[model samples]
Target: MTDENGWDMSASAWVIAQGENGDFTRQFVLDPVIDAWLAGRSFASALDVGCGEGRFCRRLKARHGIVAVTGIDPTEPLLATARAKDPAGDYRLASAENLPFEDHRFDLTVSYLTLIDIPDIERAIAEMARVTAPGGTLLIANLNPFITASGGTAWVKDDSGAKRFVKVDRYLQEHSDWQAWRGIRILNHHRPLSRYMTLLLAAGLRLTRFDEPPAIGGPTEARAAYNRVPYAHVMEWTKA
Candidate 1:
């Protein structure tokens, strides 16, 4: 691996996993909620933190009509892939804890499924807030705290090989765990929901909306499994 996070080494696998459509949670669960949140909204400039392969950055322009979109990631391989895919797009190699743009540069700043990947959650949240213009929104999509707290032991199955119930422990504890699947290995951090809320509020962001969205489309089995536990959530915070 080229980096400690393993994302540099797993970049290709990550891209493959997110093929034309995103993985199950993104396509069926998170996308619908994000679409609804962005309905009738328009932005002149947007920043996507931890934008692997620039998928959401493209979605901002192609689907939502955002004029200028800049994506940043710490992994160079992913940024290279994103740049190759969208030559005209701005994909920078940068970390969320230290954004390279001027203060209050973007009207819409987003962190989609990325908070878990950041080692310094407080610093990352502060940097994200710093770059967001006044009256702008910071949209976040993330795995639920319960789900992350499970730390890869998310389900307990019976002898019949059926899921009995989700398993969550140490809900209030903050930690990191290694996740390996589909040729991708990476570290994911887990923090209590209150940790995230406290950081956002401390950054002077007002919570505008929050939702534990249900899956709208995917394989029947996967959709059913997701709805049972609702593994992800979305939040919208605004800078007043």
Candidate 2:
């Protein structure tokens, strides 16, 4: 279900479903890509915007050698879970649209799979860019516009109950949709790829790397099919 602020209040379900690594897509596809991509970069401080359970924030300290990592989310339940897990962790209740920080406050700022949940994406992107230090990186992982164009992850099936293909409609139109999985109910917004790129460019950030990672090891047929279609886009941008 949703909260007063329109955020999904399914923190427990999300943590249980994702565990430490994340859901299937994040565990197999997104994490590997992000880890490898981050291996070549260096940052002493990091901020995870919309960090649900602060998993990435903890990982940034343990795996990526970032001594200081801060996580922020609007959902109280999620922040509670994050704090319970790491009492010493810096997990704050905040919105991506208005980060509580000064200009260029972080060496690395990240938005991991949370942009779709944000209604004011342009403002959030600007905030992310604002918090990132000059020459530092603003890494973002988001649902691919093409995939969200289908409205949801629902795919059309064939006569034998076999998945045919992902259906996409009104791709060029920007709108919001509802998604329910397990006990989680959330709102997701869809916009064309150009909209995101233009906003980032307008914010004075340069796109350095971009990739559309595919499902690696999931249900065989689904994996194969998803490989052909981009599911998510991971990008690394530097503030100029």
Candidate 3:
């Protein structure tokens, strides 16, 4: 499963499952924070690392007026879908650990829900920082360390079989977890919150923004549950 073939096999199903924007959590919670971060901060060039299907890249152009937005991923099947969806855009088959671009190539770079899937996140962060121009921004949206460290999204069932409370455990150890949905299966690695922040600092990126935004415009019951503890975390950093 470490190889890219699994994603190729799951490509069609992944596209179908994601629809035009993204999954339930992404659309309802994460996107708003990401959108707010990008708001009024247009860049000349932007890069999306591990950009599955290039949805955000297209948004960068249409919404933020970024003149050039390039998306790169190790999975060819996902890149194919991105190219098919946006014929005029630049989509490359590449890995975040080894970006195919010169240093300081982009004014802004993003890794949306992608870092958890990468095995060598330190290397990827180094490359991301390398490609971002000095004073440039690098934004990352991820499953909250608290959520992923718990292994999976789970809830405790009471006598009546209702979800009484969410379960969160293993916050101190780093590990991997598997997820499957609609014929799409993938592996995700988890690390504590301190590790992620430490990596960004070690990569010479300064943290500017951190947030755990609540789900917005979704089912009331679900939103109420998420309001207790958000499942997503967004971080904004600047190359210094």
Per-residue lDDT of 130-213 in model 2, one digit per residue for the tens?
A: 999999999999988887877886588889988777888889999988887877777789999899999999999999999988
**Candidate 1 structure quality by residue, lDDT tens digits, 38-100:** 989989899999999989998998889997999999999999988988899999989999999
> Model 2, stretches more than 4 Å misplaced?
1-8, 218-222
Worst 10 residues of 3 by lDDT: 1-10
Q: Which pairs clash inside model 1?
A: none
Q: Which runs of model 1 end up more than 4 angstroms from their true locations?
A: none
Error in Å for residue 117 of model 3? 0.5
What TM-score do all the candidates reach, one by one? 0.98, 0.94, 0.94
The top-ranked prediction according to lDDT is: 1
Q: Per-residue lDDT for 17 in model 1?
A: 97
- In model 2, the clashing pairs are none
C-alpha positional error of residue 93 in candidate 3 after TM-score superposition, expressed in Å:
0.7
TM-score of candidate 3 versus the correct structure, residues matched by position: 0.94
TM-score rank, highest first?
1, 2, 3
